[model samples]
Target: MNTASWGSAGRFGLARYVMAAALARTADGGAVVAIVLLVTTQGGSGSLAGFLAACITAPHLLGPFVARRIDLADDGRKVIAFACVLYSFALAAAVLSYGHTPAILTGLLLSISGCCGPLLTGGISSRLPTIVGSDQHSQRRAQGWDVATYGIGGTIGPSVVAAVSSWASPGLAAFCLAVAAFCAAWLVMRLPYSAPEHGGDVQNVPSAWSTIALMVKDGPLRRTLYMTMLVAFSMAALPITAVHMTTLIGSPAASAAAMTAAYGIGNLTGSIGVMLRPLRGSPDHLMSVLALCVIAGLFAVMVSPTLLIAIATFWLAGIVNAFFFAATLAARTEYAPAKGRGQVFLWVAAMKITAGSAGTAAAGAMTGWDVRIPLIVGIGLIGCAVALSFVERSMERF
Candidate 1:
């Protein structure tokens, strides 16, 4: 292909692939929300809700190992496509069993579906650089697109599930999820194979722990991973805050849904802003600003007497989230060798999942106390993250 034709074809391909990835995320998020709501309607408790959340997130902790396996495999595309099919099956099964069994079984199925999340994310992310060729600018733009897809998927997915479940049944939501996964698998199959530049022999593949150990020894990657974990922890406080608002407003379901929607809006806006102006500063500086925005936004949400004010703050926080996400991904990609990209991203996902689960659990435990406690803790965590940015800066100089 000529240069112009190749660039055009590549851009079109990337768009198609990204849209498919976004749809998969949308299905995943939508299915979780639908399942939770379905269980609640069938008399599940708040504690059960917490358990369901944990199940969905627990798979992230296993992502590192999955990514390592993908890296060692000769056909990443086939692995990703198969995972997508498995994910579709899991969601379909969960929907089928929604009200037929105990809440625990439903949670288990959802957890299994959640395990595919990191694979989808890592697989798509690793493909982007190759699709965009060597144009650093376009690659950055692609990252922005990825963030936008995530935010948009998150926002629309729940709305679709809620609507579908309401109009038909929760099982319908699973059908939607199946469609998404199928689309993703199809798109991935269409892409030309691009092997990792820093290829490694399958016989000499490193264990997950050893891969993580290597990542931690790299100064920039370690700092970026730490920041990602802190961000995840801070974001975890959103659900806690939503719970508090629901209690205070005397409309728990309605309030939770609204707040979640608002947070998604913030994320979407942030992603768009990053696309408009990709970061020019060091990763530490860029993330510090985003952290500060999150801290301020959290404080605003905590004290807001009206839901409108809370929504506004959350929207701003979402913008910060988008910027930080793009910066972090770029930094991580830069720090890791090409061969290790999948493993690095997986490690980042693992840390975020573990920290987020802990944060959520801690928030749940504090339910008897002031509902705002988690928000306060969230602020503190963001501050600590900001402080860590400075530490990263200092380490960079060495």
Candidate 2:
């Protein structure tokens, strides 16, 4: 494609994809928050809330295999479109089925929505390089846009749910989420059919599990995967911080929402950084710095128990996290074999899922031992990640 053609495709594709991503994120965040709140209101314990949280991360464990399958397909465009539609319908069904009597069915529907989550995210990651432009700079910029969209959507979605839940009802919040999902599906439907350039027949395609095994055997890919998992585990501190601030410090829901908003702002800012200047140093070096910054931010959280201070610290942590995550993703994408891009991204998603599930479960279990226990553990893990970065640097040089 010519420069003009590439630019036009990127503009059009980004516009539509961002809409879809934002809606998808809004649905995902709003549904999780709303479900937890509803369950609690219905006299359920924190265990139920934790289970719902786990539901959100559980599908990630399967994302790698899913990505492999999607990647092997000749028609990724169709797969993405179908997934979007199915996801939308599922969210809508969950919204419509909300009530006290059919609680079990409602939970099942919510879990189903979670299962569709990775398919959309992974599909987009794989599709963007094809549709936007193949150049590394252009591809990075496109991913930056994606990151910003998630931040904006994530920041807004939870606040919307919180507002609706407090003023109206959880059902209303869920309904809004359903509408967002439908909008995402509509936006996705407009894109041109773009698939991986490495065309091959289905009969020759490798199994998803085999692809994952091959990726794992690659040293840089494995290191990157570990880094992603650590970063994700560290982020578990975010929700835990919110819960702590509300339960222990007597902070209002607005405070939690503001903290989240600040975190989103940090992510947006980091995306801008990625667009403006390339991290000229090695990925390991940059990631090491980011890891230390993350630890510093977590420590800040530990010391500052008040609402405003906590919010500021969380926002700073978010900025650091944005840099860390964006850099890691860019590196992973750069290192991935062209044919294995989808599987690589899928592995990243799976790591995130595994880390998030572990972190949340641990956090929920240790909620009694000081609400900030998870944050401490997060800080320690980032420390380990920092150490691992040095090892990665040496490996790279060799």
Candidate 3:
């Protein structure tokens, strides 16, 4: 009711949710970096590094199950709060496993922690409406704030990992990530808690599988999901390309930091642009912009002769990435049915996160071929996605 409440959090936000989400996203951003560092520190090979990363992300595939439960339950916050605690403990175990345990055991602990990713990202996302109410304008602003905070977290997370790992150790970075999750848990506890049956009538609640089926049956939502998956796939090239380019340029690894900074700055800038002037158009229009950004960004990386050019291009791509996601979140908020919103939110999160992970891993394999080859493939996929969006428009006219 009062704009002041949201205003205090900065940019029309819920302070508590924004704080918790920022912490969660930071952990999400850092955990992979920490995992790689830990594996390498432990004298493990690249395969093990990839495997541990998978352990952390693979659980996203099952995120929908918890999201479904959250939707059907009275209060989703309880599920999220519990997940927060679980991640803290599980990640701690992962930290312990780094020395005494084998990679498999460490990975097992990471997998346990990974289950919390979806709940933290998508599950918490579903709570936005509860905090901000359903008014379109207010909700979009809140979502934009969310996007900005998420970018801020992404920017901070890796920096934290790199700094901590360099000065102290990779193990310490993992511990810091756990502390972030613990802090997130504490923050969630401060939020208004509700019982599990907020919606009432268990019999009326549909299963997650059925909801997913219904969602896919919709033409626009399905198309949007498919299109975004392509963007996610392309976006993977950013990290892989950054790592490779650093090696190629023989520049200090810190050069990669500049690239990341550019991306983060771009994301914050783009999110504000969306919040300032919300676009009005079909989802196809939004997806087209997203795809174009991916195409241009990747192409820039492929052709960049110097590290400076790559940084500039990455900055532009980051702007497009942030804009694409902010606009898409608002669109998803608008399209999702009231009853099934939680499931849909998590489903989208799961799909995009998984696709991004797969893209990164796949890209890693191709670095041996040529640094630019993976990004080239990423650009082509994004272009195809853009083409598909136009096809949908043409079909609608027919």
Q: What is the TM-score of each candidate against the true structure?
A: 0.87, 0.86, 0.88
Please state the error at residue 227 of candidate 2 in Å: 0.9
lDDT of 3 by residue, 1-398 (tens): 34444444333337888899889888877888998998888788899898888899898888887777786767677778889889988988988877687778888889988888888787777777667744567777677777887786778888899999999999899889889988987777676553443357666565788768866776666766777777888787677778788887677787987886787788888888777876556645776876787688778777877888878888888888887887668656777767777888888889999888788878889888888888888888878877877887788789
* Candidate 2 structure quality by residue, lDDT tens digits, 63-89: 666666666667676666666666667
Residue 222, model 1: Cα distance from true site in angstroms: 1.4
- Model 2 worst lDDT run, 10 consecutive residues: 277-286
lDDT of 1 by residue, 1-398 (tens): 22344577787877787777787778766766776776677677878766776687678678777887667777677878887888888877876876688767977887887787777776567666667655456667778888887776777888888888899876677688778887888888776677745465665566788778887777677767877887787687787778678767566457776787788888888787777876775665676777787788778778877777777777777777788888887776667666667788778866876887777778887756888888887788778867876886786789
Ranked by lDDT, the better of candidates 2 and 3 is: 3
| Candidate with maximal lDDT | 3
Best model per TM-score = 3
- Candidate 1: where are CA atoms >4 Å away? 1-6, 42-56, 97-111, 198-200, 203-205, 243-257, 303-307, 395-398
Sorting all predicted structures by lDDT, with the top scorer first, yields 3, 1, 2
CA lDDT, candidate 2, residue 178 = 73
Error of 3 at 257 (Å): 3.8
**Could you give me the TM-score of model 1 versus the true structure?**
0.87
| Model 3 ranges off by over 4 Å | 1-13, 101-103, 192-198, 243-254, 396-398
- For model 2, the stretches where C-alpha displacement exceeds 4 angstroms are 1-4, 40-57, 98-104, 203-205, 242-258, 281-285, 305-309, 364-367, 370-372
